[model samples]
Target: MTILNETATRTDRWTPVCSYTDLLPERGAAVLVGTMQVAVFRTFDGALYALGNFDPFSGAYVLSRGIVGTRGGEPTVASPMHKQVFSLVTGVCVDDPAVAVPTYPIRVTDGTVEVSVV
Candidate 1:
């Protein structure tokens, strides 16, 4: 595993989560990294995104079960519990900007999906 710190120097350290073939386009998958549950997504355009799986409104680990779509050109996922849409790139809740989830850096190397959690 590789660790990366968010600071003046933006360095990316990736940890393999799953195979790229395991993910479906425009869908989200729940993955466990350490004690955190991460929601990994593969967009229709072949873009990959990762965010915390916990939903702030419902306090449930169900972000991965949310619906994937775009709102005003920004890619987003709607929480399954309360339908709170969240930005996939920034993790900010669309309905309530103050509430947001943690977003992780993700990449696909070769045929595997990797996310930077540190």
Candidate 2:
């Protein structure tokens, strides 16, 4: 399992999860990296976001099955199990400020989606 060190510098290696074409607009897919299940999303505007696949409210690995949408112009995903909305960029829960998911740095290079689990 890869543990992310907050104090560590931003020199982590990016691992390719899937091809860009594998993702559809406003949808999410689950991918495994190390011991983590990550949810990857491609917005309608062709932007990508990655976050932890675990839904804190439901205590299930179902964030990838969430519905992608926007709240106050912020990209968000609503957990399919409990309907908790989370910000795609920051992973913050909109309804409950105390809850938040882990977010990963993601990018697209040469039509591939990559994420850093460091």
Candidate 3:
């Protein structure tokens, strides 16, 4: 008999990255998932977010090292190279709407943080 639930099956697509408490509030961490570099962030409100670690402005994988903050009530991270702010939720550049980065799906499971590239 199968005791697994639907949620458990869904979690198969999620890749565990780190513990929920490992992430400092308003800071970002970089993780590699299947050849993809992902930047994970945790807001002061205990919210988790993930975005591509590549910074379009500087053509560098330093988004994870950017400064975390907010803009217009939206969680944001500014590129450390050029200081371009990007929305953590949508991965859109707040300074330039025409340009945007990629966002990934992130979640917390049993105190562990997970990011899905697929």
Candidate 4:
């Protein structure tokens, strides 16, 4: 998996996952990017985030089903299997900053939530 940074890079051919309207507020959506399973989230504030759906610790496919909350206003998601907390924006483990998760850059263009997989 890769954590692409569109803000610093170019992705003119990003793949579309879902309409921005399709995402549940404060919920995460599991999507496919060329066979890679991903968890794309729409925060309560309307911000979008994307990360690998697989939990590195438990090897579970539950990041999409994880809980959403904040710590001192930093948005986060908890792993359902072991309750590992990770920053939605950076995909960095809050409990242990050394741990990293691939965080993809996302955008909503014309109501579509698109992500770069290249």
Among these predictions, the greatest TM-score belongs to: 2
Pairs that clash in candidate 2: none
Stretches of candidate 2 exceeding 4 Å from the true structure: 1-11
> What's the TM for model 4?
0.89
User: Any runs in candidate 1 off by more than 4 Å, and if so which?
Assistant: 1-12
lDDT of each: 0.86, 0.86, 0.84, 0.82
Provide backbone clash counts, one per model: 0, 0, 0, 0
Off by over 4 Å in 4: 1-6
Measured against the true structure, the TM-scores of the candidates, in listed sequence, are 0.89, 0.90, 0.89, 0.89
Tens digits of per-residue lDDT, candidate 2, 1-118, equal 2222222343378788999889999999999988889999988888888899999998999999999999999999999998989999889999898999998877777777778888
lDDT of 2 at 73: 98
- For model 4, residues 22-114, the per-residue Cα lDDT tens digits are 999888889999987889888887888888898887888789889988977988999888999999978998988898688877887777888
Error of 4 at 85 (Å): 0.5
Question: For model 4, what is the C-alpha lDDT against the true structure?
Answer: 0.82
What is the clash count of model 4?
Answer: 0
What digit string (tens of lDDT, one per residue) describes model 3 on residues 1-118? 1111113223457787898889999899999988999999988888888899999989999999999988999999999999999999888999999999988777776787877777
Candidate 3 has its poorest 10 consecutive residues by lDDT at 1-10
Q: Lowest-scoring 10 consecutive residues by lDDT in candidate 4?
A: 1-10
